[model samples]
Target: MPRSKRVTIADIARLAGVSPGAVSFALNGRPGVSEETRQRILAIADQHEWRPSSTARALVGSRAGVVGFAVNRPARTLGTEAFFTDLIAGVQSSLAQHRIGLQLVVVPDIGEEVDTYRRWRRSNQVDGVLMLDPRVDDPRPALLRSLALPGIVLGGSPSGPDDSATIWLDDAQAAHTVFDYLVGLGHRHIVYLSGPAEFEHVRLRSEVLAGLAERGVTGETIITDYSPTEVATTMRTLLSRQDRPTAIVFDNDVMAIAGLRVSQEMGVAVPTQLSLASFDDSVVTGLMHPSITCLTRDTFGFGEKAAEYLLDVIASEERLPDRTGPRPHLTVRESTAPPPA
Candidate 1:
């Protein structure tokens, strides 16, 4: 068999119509080449499956221009999440400007999420990472520090004022805003259908509601694990029982949609029958029949910030990384209204 031609920088440079040095800088994600030229070279490299050679590695090293994302969400949720799709889009959008690739790897299960990061850090497989679905008192941030890994935490630990780059979303405030809206709408009894138990933000959202009840709010709450297929059954149980919640706030879009289905099945009228709101207002919210009232967050922006921060962590040496977005709040739709008399 005739040996396939070895892929080389010259092949890339010739195809991209740039000098070999420019190709090197472009492929390395180094400064000096314009973003336009960098993209051009990358496209040509992709066409040929061209990778940096050992000689190139000897000079520049085998750093793949790829960012890994480790998410704790279940395969079912991850497969359907508009937030993941949009977030990944934003990250890819930002990284593509520099010819960086995105390597999205879902942990086999929640247990594997943290271990994925640990293994990646040890292997030096990615240029950086985007960590999502944070857990309270998460050890990953400290792990990153201990390993001197370069990356960004999305909506997790506040990247220390002196710590590594991290994006901390005010998850408590987001839940509070949505709940307060429902409360003002006369939803005294509220049910919070939460995400996986280990997620920190899910816990925080639940905690905020729990604390609100202690403050003399006229509301009752129930918490449960999330799965779309089972929600109809759960909601039926909740509906049949006395003292059922008048309003529901979901920690995710999937649960909110599930709640809607359950309400329909039990002949419970939306708005008139039950009020609803959820966080992470992605396509599911907008596309649903009643158009779920939900917390308005810039998920795409979150991904962008996560990517930018990771880049900074890899490049910058000064100041705690900071980026801001509009605070997430309630985007009322037809799904929520005062309970029927």
Candidate 2:
């Protein structure tokens, strides 16, 4: 005999003598159904094993109750990094309270990540999105502003290009704090190893360090693609020079970890021969034989704030938070020290 047609909510509704709407309410655990009817419809759906489908969405213009979280992080960083793990956890915290779930997508690179957001909205894959790694003059805010779609940006500015209410972190302060912390540690010659040029946060960091360098301090800017072998190769070349940098600040902890390995391989003792710091304070840093010195912004906190802000925007489009004030603070660790005398 041929296999039975794939079960649908309508099938369950027919079997239970209930409306499709009632079936949906029961399946989704919505409040419209009475307890007794809810149990009966759920029992029938369980027997048939009915699941949601976009085809049903066309039948009724409503939500699939799934939200998109589209982030643009380097492929190397995403795989070697644990910062996102905590960030995702923070979002899950808020979502669990509402019984909602996230659909995560990490694109090949920043450009593809932005493009995916546009497609997700057009295809109706999600009701809204959580965008991270905003850049200066990013096109996404403007694109999303014109569409009926709603989302929260997880960076330094605008939740929506037209509106400012989505929660955003203070990147400038985070940058400045990291720079000053290095200077305070007596790092006279410093090199800032950053991620892609398109990332606004890294750009902000470069700009901040440039201003400091203008005052006759040693600050060099080198934005490199993150890779263990690449980072090691770069450090090998940089450290071989007679006038090598005394300290290096990386944009992410994973790269800093590479820097640490490079220093060890070159017989350059950390703190004694090289000092390092990085952003994205992951547990890997602490687990290192010597924990990393980093610009410790609360990624978990940022995630929690971004999720709530997105939910608020979805509820009602609101203004973005102010960017003129203090930014995320810096928490120093063991990875940094003054140049060896």
Clashes of each: 0, 4
RMSD of each: 10.8, 10.3
Candidate 2 overall lDDT versus native? 0.73
- How close is every model to the real structure, measured as TM-score? 0.77, 0.76
Which regions of candidate 1 fall more than 4 Å away from where they truly are? 1-62, 156-164, 218-223
Best by lDDT: 1
- lDDT of candidate 1 over 1-341, digit per residue (tens): 12287778787788778898998787665798999997787667655656445574556465767788876656677667677788888888888988888878767664576556554553345767777766666677676666566767676335555344667778777778888887777666787877666777777777778777765565444556667766667788889988778888876787888889889888888878888788868766888888999888787877777787788777766545556544677788889889877
Clashing pairs in 2: 164-319, 164-320, 165-319, 165-320
What tens-digit string does per-residue lDDT give for candidate 2 at 1-341? 12367777677788889898887776665789898998788666545544456575677566646678876655455666777877888888987787767888777766676556555554356777887777666777676666566876666644443643446666667777777877877777889888778888887777888888765677888878766667788899999999999988887888899999888888888877788888767778878866787766667766776677677677764554533212455666777777787
- Residue 339 alpha-carbon offset, candidate 2, angstroms: 1.7
CA lDDT, candidate 1, residue 105: 79
